[model samples]
Target: MDGRQDEVAGAMARLAEGDRDGAASVLRAALARAPDDPEILHGMACVARASGRADLAIGLAGRAIAILPAAHFHITLGCALHEQGHLEPARAALHVATLREPRDVRGHAALAAVLGAMGRGAEAEASLRAALALRPADAALLHGLAARLSGRGAHGEAEDLYRRVRDLCPEEGAAWANHGAVLFALNRHEEALAVLERADGLVPDVAETLNNLGLVRMALGHLPQAGVALARAARLAPEDARIAVNRATILAELGEDGVAERLLRGVLADPVAAGGAEGARAAFNLGTVLLARGDLAAGWRFFEARTRLLPEGRWPDIAPWDGVAPPRGRLLLHAEQGVGDALQFLRYLPYCLERARVVLELPPELQRLVGTTPDPDGLIASRCTVLRPGGSVPGDVVARCALLSLPHLLGMAEPPPFAPYLLPALSAGAGGGERRVGVCWAGNPAYRFDRRRSIPPEELAPLGEVAGVRFVSLQHGVAAGDPPFAMEAAASGDWLETARAIAGLDLVVTVDTAIAHLAGAMGRPVWLLNRFGGDWRWSAAFDRAERPCWGDAASRWYPSLDLFRQAGPDMPACAWRGPVAAVCAALSRWRDGRLAGD
Candidate 1:
């Protein structure tokens, strides 16, 4: 190569190595010798872009393109325009560059970035795939495509591409963090934690990196570590609503409710955060905190913001049922969250029945069981019709309401009706043996809070020591592993079948799952294995000192239920021995009482 070209090459190399000063010095010397040279001008533009001087880079790139209209010059110009937030102009420039040199990867890659920023996701993905076809093994190309896929919620493909990127560029902290985030989305918390820990070590001060690490730690139930990482992230990006929301959630979980509430309130009050997705999350989290502290009125109001968190088109075009008046025709009450949620909120059907004809939509799992629920006045069997989710709505249906929205819509200042609302299957007969106790050690693993809410099966071993009690296993889907105690497997074909088994037991002990809700609805004696800062329904247990109770402690929501909470927020799931020991002692006391009665 000639002398001018050699100087430009050296400058480009320095710029690629992040030595912007060295690149600038080399480009300046080259410009002095050949002031009109396009390559030297382009090299200077790169240095200016790397230094974050997008305006200067735009000027230098324009000069290079004016001297000799080249594809590379247009690519530089497009990149500078994109950096300056002129997305349409940047897209036009990149389009011209790609048209000029259809084989150039940089032109296509830059066009993809501009398209992505413009929210033209499909076009951007197409451009990225075209660029990848030319440079199949490029780490940057793979990472970009992976991020696009991740944004589109194609986590399986994103995970595979991120794996390739990590293998190709193991030292890149961003690649590791991206990979970890994909794993976290896929619910592979252990792998995500390992990957995020590596990323935190490599980029300890990066707010986004620490945020991802904190989320992974939180999912693994490492509360203290999560708090530390998220605290640092919040400090680094104080104005970032997403980071603030996450940090506040961790604080709430850790019993630092005052600080958590303050952070969440600030986010809700900020104009930028108040209208965005993060703001909605902040509002929902604030509601949780308030409800946990027994501020029912404000909690329900703020909790209304959760509807904003739902994806667009989540509901049909039908008008929503306003809590104010009885629908002229049928009121559709649809379940929104988990089965446990549906079971808990089904109590509100009678309230809806009081106003209008009620159409209750539920998951198929609970259809048979819910069909068996009876009302002393025969309202349920006569007026309320059970429909499967997405089932055909009757032509007379006028408005719909989410099952969980009942309390909020009704403006309930206190806990709604709490009574035995379900009937045990007739087949369920009384047990005559040792006091039968049904036990469930875990909940649905797919749930976001399952790690914290679920107990390790081995912890149930202590219950074996409680004499005069027969333990019946109520766990479903997955094995709870062998405990020191003999647990008879209950015949649970469905929710109704489980209810049958539960009806026969003298008492039920379980995590926060559908079984707990079922047993409570049956007015069966139930002990809840509640996690610290668990679901809002269990708020009475969390703030029992301030919360009013109709029956025993923590049974305001379910008069027949009791609660066994984690000793503290920072206690890991494996350290569940404390609650298990408590249950063991309680069981022994109950046994002694029964013996004394006999």
Candidate 2:
């Protein structure tokens, strides 16, 4: 090869070795000889990208493509644009690369990636299939299709493809990692661990692979193992913001929020680290830390970053109410979170700005519960198996907002009045005054923290022993079976009957579940058995300090409800202990009033 070509090859070698400075130096010399050489310009662009100079890389790649119109040059430009979050332009550039070299496998893969990011799932899958047909067993193409399908929520199909990729190409580290990720997404943690271990064994501990393993381990409640994996990942990739965020989460779970807060803050301060997907996540973690410390203003500000983290089309087309009082017309308020969250925030409806005319869109399971309440202007119950725009709503809706956003929008410095928001009853009373008490021991199992929040049925045996207290079951779901206490079966999936049962009860005691919120909203006497160091909303530090509402046993959020926290320092979050003895002791002090304390 001639001297100019030799210089280009040497520059490429330096780029491959991650010596971007040396690569650029050599590329400059080559470009000096052949000022318009596409190969030299492309080599410089790759070097720029290696050093995190995406704009410079795009500029050089554009110059290279202008000279030679090569697929490799456009591919480099597309990749740089993708990293910078310019998906549409990236897709256009990648499309040009595919046209320039129809059989360019990497170009097709890059195009597929950009298309997926743009939410064009079908086109992305087609691109992958086209590339896969050329090299049917290629690990990259197979893994691409597998990841695309997984992103589409087809975990079963993704798992099968991921299994094939791993088996067919045992030496490829990505195949193993992809298989493990899909398994974890499917809630098959044991299989996920096995697959991740296989990947770690093959690659011997890449930062991303170890990070995924740590996440799966954390989900399985193996805190020590998760800590070990996450610590190692942080060491390997100290600059990776996601590793720091994951480590912070584990630390918070272990009740070490002080250190976790510092780690998350450092990630947010680093511009490069706080950009892309990890940026919004760091903001979220920081928001939780601030909220836990009772810093509402800053906490809510950072918490709003959640919208940026969410995927496209997660909400409807209506403009979200920007914390403003409407002139007229009904505001379409919808529940965007879990049942418990929806129930908990309903207290804010009466306090809405200017006594706003509000309509609600709730899941069908919650219809019967809301039916007892006469507050909302109107209610629309619908099934949301697949999300889309324009849910059933009344006409003349001026704006929309998720129910969870109300507290922040209202600038609520303190909890609203704890008076009963839901009406008295929808069904006839149980007709007896034999000290009737209702109990719930479990929450929706699909909740991420259900294991920590739910008390095992066997642990509730103490409640059954309380003399003169009729223990009725308010428990729902498949977990509803024989409570240690006697429970009359209400119609399955019937929430109104459960409400009626609660209305007739002298007191209701429950763990952190939707029923807890329901009983509290009804202004009935209730005892909330909380886990140690639980969700921030339950923490005494969550509310303003001077109002004197939060105590060890009292909550500002609900005046009729008393809280009984599990013993701390030794009570693990994943334990099966119940606070029934606390309830029994309080029942002994009861004066037979509607409120527990009275």
Candidate 3:
């Protein structure tokens, strides 16, 4: 080879060995001698990119492209532009690279990523498909496709693709991680854990896989293990905000609010976590902890970040409508998150109805469950006019907001008053009871904070001791394991059956899970069992400390209900026992008329 070619090859070798500084020095020396060498310029760009000097890389790549107009140089420039967040320019450069070299899978894949970030899923999917066609056995291409499908809520198809990728490349850590994520989304916690564990073992230092493992462990009620995994992930990727946020979430569950707050603050201080989805998560988590600590204003500000935290294309593209609607027009309100979230935020429907003609889009499951929510003018329906996977309002609607944002829009300082809201049919043999008391010892196990919030059935045995109270299990679909406390188990066919049983009861006591939110929304007298770091909604303090522990005992915002909190995380069982005893004693006194009724 000629001397110049020999010099370029040496620089390329240094870059390949991850010695960016060495590569840069060699490239600079070659460029000084042969300042217009296309190969040397490209080599300099690669070194600059490896060293995190994206702008320098862009300039160098531009020079190389000007000299030889090579597709590879355009790909290098695209990558550098992407790093600088010049997405449109990066996309244009990637398009030129693909045009110059149609068979270049890497160029196509880079373009797919840029298109996906721009919310052009259809185009991105097409690009990914083209890349896959060129390199059918490529594990990275399969994983990327699976991720895109998963982001669009095509879980079944995504799961199939993930499994296929894993089968083909059993040792690929990213494939296993993707598989775990899909399983977790499907609520297969055990399978998720196994998959994540496999990924963790294969690539022990990958921060993303470790984070996924931590999430699964948390879901399975393994708090300490989850904490360890999350901590390790944070340590491995100190600059990654998601790892820090995940770690903080686990800490909050462990009731270490002080530590969680500090970690979240530290993450927010990093510029990378300041404006996008990561920033939103950091803000939301930080707000949640603050709200639990009773810092309302700051908590609400952070809470607002929830909208920004959604995946790039998941949120509605339409602008939020001003409260003042066009004459004779309607405002669309859509649900986000879980059923409990929909119910909790439904309290704002009445206020919204007062301002505009309201149409609410809800989960199909809750369609009949929340029939005519807020009554009269507000129309509640299962389907939207323009149904999109991630919630979206109608194009014709002047404005829209997520149901959870109603409280903020309504200018409410505190949660609206509670009343006996949803009234599903009572089950056979549910009524005619002498002060029925409903109970739910556990919650959805998939929740990351389930370990802190849910109690095992065995811990609820104390409630069976309460005199004049007919304690009945209101948990439905899921099994209620044997409780140490003596209580009668009531069989339920569905949520309606559970609701019917709860209707018969004078009160219901549950953990800070969906049931607690359901009971509260139903305007039932519900004694909510809360952990030290409870969810944002339950942080609101209420009155009426004594009541039937069931269906509408006190009228003052379920004035009939009460709140029982664990004193600390070390021994939550001990703290919970005292509240159970107190509740039992109160029920006995109320049954005896020792406490006068209003």
Question: Best-fitting candidate, measured by TM-score?
Answer: 1
Model 2 error, position 207 (Å)? 2.0
Candidates in order, TM-scores: namely: 0.83, 0.69, 0.60
Task: Give the per-residue lDDT digits (tens) of candidate 2, residues 466-561.
Answer: 676766778888778757656665434556666777778878888888888888788887888887666777776643333322224666677667
RMSD of each: 4.6, 8.5, 8.5
Order of the predicted models by TM-score, top scorer first: 1, 2, 3
**lDDT tens readout by residue for model 1, 1-598:** 3988888888888888889999899889889888898888888898898998999999999999998999999999999999999999999999999999989999999999999999999999999999999999999999999999998999999999999999898898888989999999998998999998898788788899899888888877888889999999989998999999999999888888899999999998999889999999999999888988888888888887888898425457668877866637788788888778888888878876777788888878788888777788888877888876567888888888898788788877577757777787645455876799998878888876588888776667778777778888888866555444688888858788888888899889888888899998999888888887677778653334433221124567776787877767655645577777777777777766632123
After superposing candidate 1 on the true structure, give the runs of residues whose Cα lies further than 4 Å from its correct spot: 1-103, 163-172, 311-314, 388-390, 428-434, 465-468, 479-486, 540-554, 592-598
User: Local error of candidate 3 at 192, Å?
Assistant: 6.2
Error of 2 at 58 (Å): 21
* lDDT for model 3: 0.74
Regions more than 4 Å wrong, model 3:
1-210, 256-259, 265-272, 310-318, 324-328, 364-396, 417-430, 445-452, 458-471, 480-501, 540-558, 570-598
